[model samples]
Target: MSATICAFILTFSTLCGSRVVSGVLSAPTNVSLTSYNMNLVLRWGPPEGATQDLVYTTEYKTSVTNYNVGCVDIITLECDFTSLSVSMHPPIIEYGTYTGRVRAQLGSASSAWVESEQIILDRDTIIGSPRVSLLSNGAAIYVSIVDPVFVISTLRNTYAFATYSITYWNGSQKEKARHINNTQQNHVILKDLEPWTEYCVQVQINVDRNPNPGQLSETVCESTTSVEEAPWVPLMVTIFFVALAVTLVAVTVVYRKSISHFLCPKDALPQHFKENLLKPPNSTIYLDSHPPVEKWHEVQIIADTRTVEEEGPSGGSKDCLQRTA
Candidate 1:
């Protein structure tokens, strides 16, 4: 009877020790949220010195709701709760203040809940394709909002719906123009343009009625028409060529006359003077010595001697003979 009692006591003590070891091995630590979107993700490390694999689960709550969303079975340390379609629910109406919790598990056992930091989702108007332009000099750019009216209608009274300002870079300086309120046409023509230069424009939409805006739409760029060349240049060039041709013709006529005078003087001289200048002169001769006086006297006596010689020179011959004797 004593041996049987001792055997029963030893068996009970061994069973109790086994229970304690199993409980310590299944505990968990380092719980965290790896991701959050429509769905949530929870992760945790195995219990300290745990030999077997562990599972995890997550829960969430909003300010309005007190009941925790049901738990999800996570076979691995990491688990996704996206299947719950949390994102589809309107973000907590309150700007912020939502909570989440993660639990670690192994088989039937579960770890204490690990809570997450509270977060909030803010609301604002989403503007898309905001186009602006200048209608004329000092004119505001027409603003066209491509987003549906319903999306922007909510903010009509809000600062987001107010008139927009058009700002542009003009070479060295910045220029701005104001847009009319509530008009939807985006086409604007810039007048008094600098004739030939570039301009870049952007529309400023006031968000949430805040003096300091929250976000900016994409910027659009355009420029005014360039100045054109003067119309008289072609006509001026044609007149210049015509004058040049006339001058060339006058010069050619004068040059031809000068050349004829130099090369053929006879053609240029008077007709009477030309004939006389071409005729030859008559010839003339000179005697070297005169014949004796007797030759000269006989020549004179033969011709009709007019004085005593012509009457019959009787007295003249006698007188000449006495003088000779």
Candidate 2:
């Protein structure tokens, strides 16, 4: 009977040790926070030996005194928390520090708490809508902070401090134009810009000097002025004037030559001589005379005959005979 009891005890001890070994192997490990923005995310490796399904439970603690202010159950290796209201309620706290841990469970067995590194949960003050306007010689951008309603009695000034910067893209590259403290006036002049070129500008603001700054505001795009001139019109006017002057000179020369040809002739002579030279002369001749007497006849006879011809017929016959000879 003693030998049988020893065998049964040995068998029971072996079974219990095997079960404990399996449970230890099944616990998750290497649990840590992967990334965080406003919320927290936890990631861990899968459990080891046990085949049965396992679940993970996460808990957050704002203070070391209270370790279980919030809890969540997750079946997968990853877990996400959209909202963390742990510090807001009953146990009032300051602006920054918070801690959290995660655990794995299977059936009746549970693993140890895998605590995370301490993280800060500070309140972020957002810069309000920025004012943009065009100035006389440049552009101006104004940034303001949204006033928080809850006032802290310890601090004298309630206004949150903010820093701002203005940047402009000059087609090929970007340049930092100005830096403003506490959201003051930011003005930048667009000098020496190429005509008809495009420019892009951006304004950035950071509150509480957070290293990872907020989103950049929308870009403002504008084009420069044109540079072409009205030279063609002037050129056309000059050409027209030159052509008009040349035409007037040609007309004047032609008129002068025509007037000189008409008023003054190359050959100079008297008007009467010119007219007689131009007229045609007559060819016929006219004469009134008596017939010439013969040489032998005396002068008295010739004269008597001439007188008789004038008075009678005998004288006319004699004058006819003398004219025949």
Candidate 3:
């Protein structure tokens, strides 16, 4: 009886311990991949209740050229290997077959390894074309690009660094293509264009310096402001300002005297003067009375001798009144 009880307790204890061990570890699931713009990304979902405490490792292999194999430790749910270095000569003897796998680890516990399906990479490897918009930025066309807004998860994991190509034709026989190299720059300015000429622009992708270009976006057409139209606004503005200034100067010159007088006024007289006068007496005492002897000296009245002698013809005496003092 004791042996049976011991066996049952031992089995129950073993079952409880197994449950506890299983609770601490589980394999990852919902593993997926995406490749966009030639950039390869791998992703997976942890088993239920797994938090950021989980760390994952990814392994990839190719079936072509050298059957490349490499692994990287990832702390996030997603891992980007856009810069992953490996033999990329596509087709593992099976048309560019490539595969990847992932597993989780925590302390000394680990989840089982999960593998992915074979994938093929080629010209038709489902690369999403970028969406492009255009703006007429004075003498140049502003080209703005964006990665495909809507893309499936699987293909989004796979992509490579891309170069944007701005090809334009100005109604000429020769079409020119300019390559912009800073990776994933959303904007590029197309300069050195002819005004008043119709221009067509098309943008495309060159993945990983591939010789064959990806699909081209739709063509956009626009025309620049004409040379005659360019200077009209500025010329009119200049003439208006010049006329205003001239009018102001002429008005000031015409009213210069008035302006100066208003600024500083003059008085009526320069200086003031006072006068002194003597009044005449009512009766003339000096005219009627003889001169006072002490204040006056009288001179005898004399006549000229030659005149007195020669005055016999007329029989009139020549008299002279003279005062000698």
TM-score of each: 0.32, 0.42, 0.36
Ranking by TM-score: 2, 3, 1
lDDT measured at residue 183 in model 2 versus the true structure, 0 to 100: 47
Off by over 4 Å in 1: 1-60, 67-143, 147-166, 171-195, 209-212, 226-325
TM-score of 2: 0.42
lDDT values for all models? 0.49, 0.52, 0.60
lDDT of 2 at 223: 57
What are the per-residue Cα lDDT tens digits for candidate 1 across 224-250? 445443435656998999999988888
* Model 2 RMSD in angstroms: 30.5
**RMSD to true structure for each model, in Å:** 28.2, 30.5, 22.7
Residue 158 lDDT in candidate 2: 24
Q: What lDDT tens digits, residue by residue, belong to model 3 across residues 102-206?
A: 888776777777776655544324455667776664567667776654222322233446567777777563346444553456687767877766667777766
Quick one: best lDDT, which candidate? 3
Order the candidate numbers by lDDT, best to worst: 3, 2, 1
lDDT of 2 by residue, 60-165 (tens): 5664556653445568776654344535533323344556677777666777777777655334323333434321212322222222222221111322464556
How close to the true structure is residue 209 of candidate 1, measured as C-alpha lDDT?
Answer: 32
